[model samples]
Target: MNRPTTLREAIEAADSILIGAGAGLSAADGDHHSGPVFDARFADFRDQRGITDAYSGGFYPFPTSEERWAFWSRMISLLRYEAGPGQVYADLLGLVSERDYFIITTNVDHRFQTSGFDKEHLFYTQGDYGLLQCSVPCHDATYDNEKWVRQAVASQEGMRIPSELIPQCPRCGEEMTTNLRVDARFVQDAGWAAAAGRYEDFLERTCVDRVLYLELGVGMNTPSIIKFPFWRRVYDNPEATYACVALDASAPAEIADRSLLIRGDIAEALASARG
Candidate 1:
């Protein structure tokens, strides 16, 4: 049988599904870290600072907190609020929504939540654009930034937010930063811990069942988190199947027979599998 048909059969046969997603999934959905949208939204950064994309923009060392918050606020609004969960995410959800499934993703955009996945069944290992934590990490907590982000995006001028709008950590008065897992300073708040526990629980409950480890658009940026784990689990569980759909896909020879590798467009592969 063809790869997509084989993937369809695997999904149908599995008692539970575990989805692992990465930046490629969002990129395939046109929500790239840097692209036309980034260029258009951050033209000033591109022209003046040579900061081309959201990914690099986050790392840019702005001279002032006002400038830093201005860039970040707009980025959060654009990536987290303004961008829609494109057809790729929706299509992927459609294929697994009817089954017992859980999703673990490194992408910070919250696309799975936006695409109608149950929040309780999803684990976002890399934090979120919609959350902010102290740069010094004064406490183990994150603050919601939607209201502040939209406000800053509206009130900013000259690529600087009004000094008054800059978020300060409520506990220690330190400056706030995106809650992404870029460094050791990243905060794992109560919600994050709870989600992690639930993910572990899901794995324990389903480990012996006929599980399908479906990885979508995952790449080498963080193999240990999803890609490697999926391979290891499939190797350990004879009843399990491993399927990967990405622009590029590969698997070790040991589990080659149990692996269904589809190297192509993610959306197309998902559609074919669902058929």
Candidate 2:
């Protein structure tokens, strides 16, 4: 495999590329760290000990389902619609949008799409912060979450957040909420279904072609979705060339000969890649 010193070289060697993004991408792009409430709550959780962001938080400690919904809805409200300007993400998208590419991200914040990426070209592996779905997995429908999130902020009462942010289903009117893919029961409403179909279709169309895989700011904590499977795919495909922009500069040992491992910040590396 020939190593690329510039963006042109990277594109010349491969037919198309598939991008995988993670939290670090948004962080590097200057989005605020979760939220002010996040810092306070994280400290409090640690102060109590033995308690973490519960995986099955919808069913976690709370006298009633309403309280549980309150905690989770507040969390969802903070992370999705609310974030910093997306100039970094938009710039990155401009560089790649011209090429035959598809993006998959674990970021629930709609940054990629908000930055002008076509909605059909992206697959948000994690549920979107901007959308709400039925908590009971009733049917495939989604609603914009902005109104409720705004309501939550407007009705703010101290650090606990406003109760109105907690969403309820429109159909059954029972506990409707963000479609964040945190566990086994996450619902994929209409938009999710369409996005997922595009993702699968992208993979299908590209299956017969040689692909360039670009991984940005992904790490091992969620190895299966972002990091490790990427390494495995590149390793298994002899025609593929891999590149990653990560804080840790390490290549899959098995594919080190065919990969470009850049140890740097994502926004900086994106600049380098574009140049």
Winner by TM-score? 1
- Segments of candidate 2 deviating more than 4 angstroms: 5-8, 34-78, 159-166
Residue 121 displacement in candidate 2 (angstroms): 0.7
TM-score (all chains, Cα) for each model: 0.96, 0.81
Models, CA RMSD each: 1.8, 3.8
lDDT of 1 by residue, 83-190 (tens): 888888878888888899998999999888888999999999999999999999878989899999999999999999999998988989978888999989999999
**Model 1 TM-score?**
0.96
Error of 1 at 272 (Å): 1.7
Error of 1 at 251 (Å): 0.5
Clash list (residue pairs), candidate 2? 168-176, 169-176
Over all chains combined, what TM-score does candidate 2 have?
Answer: 0.81
Regions more than 4 Å wrong, model 1: 1-5
